[model samples]
Structure formats: structure tokens, C-alpha cells
Target: MIIKRTIRPLFSVIFVFAVAAVTLFFRAIVSGAGRDPYPDQNPFIISQTKHIPSLFNATLLKFSDVDLADASLRQNVEQLVDGDFLSFRTNRQRSFLSAGRYRLDIGVRNVRGSAMDLRSPEFHQLRLDFRRVLKDWWRQRRFDSEVLSKSNLVNALKGVKYKSCAVVGNSGILLKSNRGEEIDRHDFVIRLNNARIGGYERFVGSKTSLSFMNSNILHLCSRRGGCFCHPYGEKVPIMMYMSQPIHFLDYAVCNSSYKAPLMVTDPPLDMLCMRIVKYYSVKRFLKETGKELESWSGLHGGTEFHYSSGMQAIMLALGVCDKVSIYGFGKSDTAKHHYHTNQKTELSLHDYQAEYDLYEDLVNNPQAIPFISDKFKFPAVVIHR
Candidate 1:
């Protein structure tokens, strides 16, 4: 009986030790390397995609219903159809706003008539084949309190008078171009990703009055559940409202301010305000009130990026800043990566001669400002490929 008691006690002790050991080992595993129970924490801007399917078929016709502003003239775009007008491809990316190294125009033209108005039957046949080229766009999602945040920079930017801004593209050239200090000297500086120099006050000076970012970028740089390049603590002032006001996972996240800064472009920043946001008027929106504007957009929300780099450069040159410089834009027909950030999609070869010709026509138009770039020399874009 005594031996049985001793055996029982020994077994009980062994069981207790085994339980404790397992708990400790599990805790150690949880605390060890490769233990990443955390969320995405990259310093790049990555808005979790809505409207777009997480996994899309490599081959599918994609079209954008979003507006392209000046890129798409109000007049329906109709011209010669040589069986190839435009096409879209999303093999490894959610969207390609512009074609990469290859010469491709990345946008949709609003044609008033149906897809069957081309002169030759080949045109109609081509349209059917290219249907997937015109059927993709980011959709609008409801503002989930748990998932979305409004523009905090906008609310904090009251009474700040920012006149000019320099949006520095972080091309490899920026490292050697010697434009760093000059870019920082401007009233504002917009840099993407961590880009090293953003926080180095010693290198680039103070924060460039306001920073402009897209949703994909903001999500990557957020700290709560995102990246932290500008770090979410110190409040940056709000500047002009950006284009493609996507709040609804449709609205943008800007600071509210009473004294609105100078809008960098025309048609007004308030025009970019979400239809869902209340106090949507430009006057009220810029008054620095911390109120959400009533959403005027339908369920689909505005998911298009209306301003291309060229368009934004033009907008800034014409409205925001007195002088403008271009860098890190337009590859040499060989530097084929479409985006500076982490976009895995490849651009399709779509003939945009019609669009390019259209742009050229505008340049020669009588109403265009002859010396538009002012004193800057815009190298003639060799588009004869």
C-alpha cells in the first residue's frame, strides 16, 4: 500500500511537470524568431484593395468606369480602329494606371455610342476580343469604423498658409541628381515610402509642410495596422484635397482645417470631396471643420485616379507652384517596371496612337499656352515606336 501511494505521488508529480514544460515550450515558441502574429508593417503605402477581387483571373477584360478628367475629353472618343485600340491586363497587379517601360497609354476614353460604331467590321470584332480590357476598376466600400479612418491631416491643417509644394519622385536619379535640398527647400515635399531622407531633418530639413499620399500608400505606412514612414503620431498639416476622392474605403484620409491652404490645381480640391462626406461644400470643407462631408457618390464610389503624373505635374505647374521640375517619371523604353512601389501587374501593349495624337493636337491648338512649361525645356517625347 505504501509503495502504491509513493507511485501515485510520483505519477502526479510527473504529470504536473509535463504540463508546465509544455506551457513553457509553447510560450518560448510564441516569443521566438519567425513568430509574426502581427499585421502588415511595411513602410510603403498599401491600401487594402476593395472592389477588386483578392484573386482575379489572369485573363479577363477590365474597364474603369471612374472619370479621367481631361485625359478623357467629354466628346466620345472615336477614330480609326486597326483591330487594336487599347487593352488592359492584370496578371500580377490590382491595377496599372500607366503602362510600364513599353509605350502604352493607360486610361479609358468615354465613347458616347455603343461598341459597334466602328467603320470596319474588324473593329467590332476586335472590340469583342478586347472586352476584358475595359472591365476592371476598384469598387467603393462602406466606411467601416473598424476598417477606415478619415483624413486626420486635413483636420489639423487650420490657418496654415502653404503656397508651394515640391512632390519629389524617388527615382534612382534622386540620389545623384543633387535635387534633394532644392526639393526640401520648397514649401512642401511629398515623398513615397520611407525613402530614407523623410525623417533625416539634418538631410532634408523639416517636414515638407504637407504630404500627399494615395490609399494604397497610406495603408502601408500606417502604424496601427500599417506601415509607419511618416509615423502616425506627429500631426502633419493638411494641404489641398487630392484627386479621385475615394472615401468609402470611398473617402480620403485628410486633416480637417479651418484655413485651407492654396489648392495646387483648378476645379478646386473641394471638387474631390466625397459625395458621402457631409459639409461637402468647398467653402465648408476648407474651413478646417472636423466634420465628415455627406457622401454624394453612389454605392460604387469614385475609384479612379483622375490625375496622372503628367496631369498632376501640369496641375501643379499651372496652379500650385510657380516652378516645377520632373524626375523619376517616364522610363527609357526599357526600364519596364510600371510602378515605383510594390505592384506586381504587367502592362499590356495597347495602341494609344489616337490618344497620343489627341494630346499632340491639344499642344498645337490655338487656345493652348504656347510657352506652357514656362522657361523649362520639355524634351520632345520620341513617340514614333
Candidate 2:
């Protein structure tokens, strides 16, 4: 009886240990089943079991047979699985129809596709209309053809390409930075609106390879005696985009006597700038606020809404320079709207925040930029505060 009692307790202890061991073994196996196979590889890879639902939803949204066949879509799905909420939302918007309906068609596509082609019939008509207006003004003024030909910017810059270019803006943040020497180091330096550089050369460089201005600035300059627009010296090239249709008269008068090239922006290039800025502005508006796209015009000036000169200069630099650096392109509450001017308020027309977002995207992921052709290779960009 003593041996029986002792063996019975021992068997009970053995049974308890056996049950515990089996429980732990199964728990370990189940835990390991959801673990990452290569924990050290690809930090963006989805590892947590909780995120499986999100992964599955994204996969379902993107996983059509056609999309599955596309290797790029597969890569995009992998990126989506890593939780890029903004991109995911943008994809959701694209994949869904109006009024909460869904569409099965899915593949990698730009949120807004490329701008109108320069060779398209619409562009040709635009060019013709622009030339007709300019020619009508030229006939009234009897402008010299020889002088106009001499000042042709496209001809002058036909073979010209810069290895490095700096596009300097007039934001008041420039006053806080001593980037003059750094700005001057570029192969070419482009200044906007002829911002004053005499007393502020330490903060803004004195070197000026090109001056980019809007038609309004030139019109104001035209009011002066001799139409004196040479803020950056007479030898510096000036590129201006038309702000009003009547500005061609100012161009005709100024280009006649200007020693350096004074050229209007190409019609196609102007259209391209317009489309790109609008796309960015709309995207930013939708992302930040609950307002609809139609409400954008009312928030921004209705007919007066226009891109700033700085944005267009950056776009021009992207096309002509191998490396582009942006300086003095931000705003602050304590700072003046322009470093050289007493104006303390920004104009309502420019969406500076959207432009800044564009600059960030340009620096971080140029491939994600919308309304630009894939055939155009984007230059390396850096933004200086």
C-alpha cells in the first residue's frame, strides 16, 4: 500500500509535466509560423501578423489578372503593403468610381497623367494664337525683325546646357541664411524677379547668369524712362513669361534695344508649367482639407490664381541643368514676404505651400511627380533653407 501511494503521486506529477510540455511546444510552433523569414532584410517588408488584414485589402484592391501580370504593379503592391497611407489613399481614389462605386481596373498609373504634348494639335493652335497676337502688336509697333531674331532665347540656348544651376527665390527666409558663396558656386545662377542684390550680397549672391521675371515686372519696368529693366546688368539674359496678353507690346519694345537676349517663354513651356502647378495645387488641396476640387478657385483667387515666378524657374532649370539647387524658397511669419521688399504679406495667387511640397517631392522622389512626361529625365535637386 505504501509503494502504491508513492507511485500514484509520481504518476500524477508526470502527467502534469507532460501536459505543460505539449502546451508550450504548440505555442512555440504557432508563434514561429507568423515570424519573418529574413528579419534583417528589407525594412519595409510587412512582418506583424496584425497588419495582415491591411495587406489583404490592398492586395484585393490591386490584384486584377492584368495587374498581376504587370511586374511594376507587383512592386507597387509590395510598397503598398508597407503602409504608405497617402499613396494607398490616392490609389483608392483612382480605383473607385463616383458615388462610392468601385472599379476592378487596377494597375500602376499616375494620379494625374502627363501634360499635353508639345506636338499635339491643341498646342499648335495655342502657339498660333500666341504668335498672331504678338504679330498684331508687332505690326502696330513696326518692331525690327532683325533685333527680334537677335534676341531669340531658343536660338541662343540651342546648344547651351549647364552642369549645375542654382535657382534663387525671393522668400524672406533667405535673410536668415548666408548662402551667397554657395549659390555663386554653381555653373549657372538664375535669379527671380530681379530681386535686389546690392546691399544683401552676403545673403543673396551677386552673380547672375539669367534673370527670370513675369510680364508684370517687365510692364512695371517699361513704365520707367528707356524701359530700364537691367537690374542684373545689360549683358545678362532675361527670360519673361507673359502675365497678360497685352504684355507682348512691352516685350517688342524692350527686346528691340536690350543688348542681351530678352525672350518670352515658349508657349508650350508655359502650358507645361501651368499644368504642373495646377496638378500640385489640386493634389495638395485635396490632401490637406475636406474641400472639393471645384472650391479651389474660390479659395485661391478666381481668375487671378497663377503660379509664382520661382516655380517656373525651377521647372526651367530641371529641363536645362544636370543638377539643380534651390535657395531661399520658404516663408516664415516673422519674415517679410520678399527679402528685398517691405511687403509683409504673400499674394493670394501663389500656393507657396503646394510649391514647397513639390520641391520636397522633387528632391525625394522625382518619379512620383505628376503631369510630367516619363521621357524627360529629371535632374538631381536639392533645396536649401
Candidate 3:
């Protein structure tokens, strides 16, 4: 045991060296791409129209080398998954329909079954009721009044140069390194269920950007005991979004895009739901006019498969930026025991690892510039050095 213990230090040193080498190599690759000359444009914006966008189709794959200038192709893909973008509902019926499209029913209501044949009539009736509720929502959507304004956000971002932002998950490791400040310093910072940022000023620091947490996280509150991880209750981000003033850009990427079993934000059913993210791509376009686009798949509507948890943030990322660096994303192998944040947004009844692996594969396999924060797991702050 002593021998192993003594050798363990040596092994850890070598491992760290390898990681450092990889980091350097990765940075070189990233910086080289940075220097490759801006492609005379920004991607992620679409041509605005009077009517809603229509869905084209969805593939299991994502494209890193997408050509952004092709508006028609981009628009098709977006229309397909647009249905999953920013749904929130209040009632059980509304929530079920909003979320059900993305959830594949596998068992008879045991786990989500791929086939609903075995579902009880009660379940079938529930599904029907939810479907009706969604249709009503769709009808109400036409009457929705969306308001978007450009503010001084860009100026607020003076001296900030992170073109690619990494949205971190709430794993406990952030507490170790005081990553909150580091995250805030990034050109852009998106935190998922940003629960424990309050009072841990040394750790969380001055977070300027927005968060993407749902009502459940708001209700349950993600602060547990001791480790800044848990199921404690407190005020949440939704209220902030409701009250905060304009920056050129400020938003909370909704993780539950497809599952908007919406509760009325104000009184009156006449008041439609308003989310800034629905127009994220447009904002990207407004920021940079000339960049070519990749796929605009997210602009439309589609079947249930489109809106899974954590998908919204990525989709929002896809709509606005060319190169993306995902942070706080949990690894497929260790999702259940994810050591980052307190609560994980569950996307399915199936094994989380399998689904997460699939999601990660869809991103990395496409050769996108993935600054995956999930790969390195350790104590406290891992300063970029």
C-alpha cells in the first residue's frame, strides 16, 4: 500500500503533464482557427418574416462545417425543432403535451416507452388531453406579442473578447476553484440552474450574463447543505429575467424548451409567453451581418423527439455562434453522480449515460470546436493555466 501510495503521486504528476500538453495543443488549434481570418461575417441570424417558421426535418447528426449563407437549408432544420425551443406550462395537461413530444414512451408508462401500445387508457386519455391543450397553446401563440429590443449590452462587454462562451453545469467542483468569478470573466457566461451563486462572492464573483433554469429549479432551489449542492428552496432566476433591464444581450437559455407546461407569467391567459431566446439567432445576425450560416434547423417545429433537456442551450448556441465551447456539461459515464452542480435536468427515462453519450457524439463527431469543460474533473478551481 505504501509503495502504491508513493507511486500514485508520480502517476498523478505524469497524468497532469499529459493534460497540460493536451491543453496547449488544443489552445494552439483554437488560436490558429481564430487567426484564420474572420469569414467576413457572423452566423446564426435568419431573415425575419410576418408568420411563424415551419419545420423541415431533423437528423441524428450535427454539422460543424455548416455553410451559413444558405438560408433555405438552415431555415428548414430550425423550423423542425422550433417546437422544442421555449415551452413552459402550468397545468399537468399542458406540461405533458409540451414535454411529451421529446419523450419516447418505451414501457407501458413504466419508463418512457418507444411504443405507447401498452399504455393504459388513462395514459392515452392523458396524452390526448395534453395534445388538446397544446393545440390551444398553438392557437394562443398566434396572438402572442413578442417584443425585442437592442440595448447597450455590447458596450457593456467592452474589453471582453470571448467569442465562444462556455455554459457550465452546477457540479460541486466550481466551488473548489472559485470558478464563478472565472466564468463571469468570460466574454459570455451561461450557468445552468445557477443555484449557489449568492453570497459565495469569492467563488461566484460578479456574474454578468444570464442563467437557464426552469420553474422546478426555482421552486425546489438547487442549494443543498455544506457543499453548495442540494434541494434547498430560495428565489430563482426567472424572476430576475422578468425584472432585469436590457444589455445589448441578456438571456437565460431554457433547458426545458420542449416541455413548457406553462404557468401564466402575469394574470390573464391573453398575456402570451415571452422568451428572448426564441430570437437568439436574430440577435446574432443583428450583431454580425455577413457571416455565413450553417443549418437553421431550430427555426421550425417538429415531432416530440426535438425537445430534450439540455438541448435548448446547445440549440441556442448553434443559432448564434460559429465556434462553441460547452462547459459544465456532465459526462455520459458519470451523469448520475455528476460532481459539478447539485441537480441535473433529466432528459429521459432511459439511461442518462447512453443519451448523453449520444448528445456529445452528435457534437464532437462533427469536428466542431468543442471546449468541453466536462472532460476535466477535479477539486476547486482549475485555472486555465
TM, every model: 0.33, 0.62, 0.32
lDDT of 2: 0.65
lDDT for position 265 in model 1: 23
Name the candidate, 1 or 2, with the larger TM-score value: 2
lDDT of 3 by residue, 1-385 (tens): 9999999999999999999999999999988755524344232222122331211001111232122223542332233223321222221211212334243223222122122342467445544443453344334432212110111222223323345555555444445555555556565555555445556556545453445544344322211111111222212222111110100001111212213221212211111111112122223333444433332333222111122223344433332333345544444433432343455555332233333433454454422112222232211112121
Root-mean-square deviation of Cα positions for candidate 1 versus the true structure, in angstroms: 24.2
Candidates in order: C-alpha RMSD to true structure: 24.2, 17.6, 23.4
After aligning candidate 3 to the native by TM-score, how far in Å is the CA of 266 from where it should be? 20
Model 2 Cα lDDT, one tens digit per residue, 283-306: 666557757656766786755567
- Considering TM-score, where higher is better, how would the candidates rank from best to worst? 2, 1, 3
Give the per-residue lDDT of model 1 (tens digit) for 334-359: 44233234333322211122123223
* TM-score-superior candidate, 2 or 3: 2
Candidate 3, lDDT over the whole model: 0.33
Score each candidate by Cα lDDT.
0.31, 0.65, 0.33
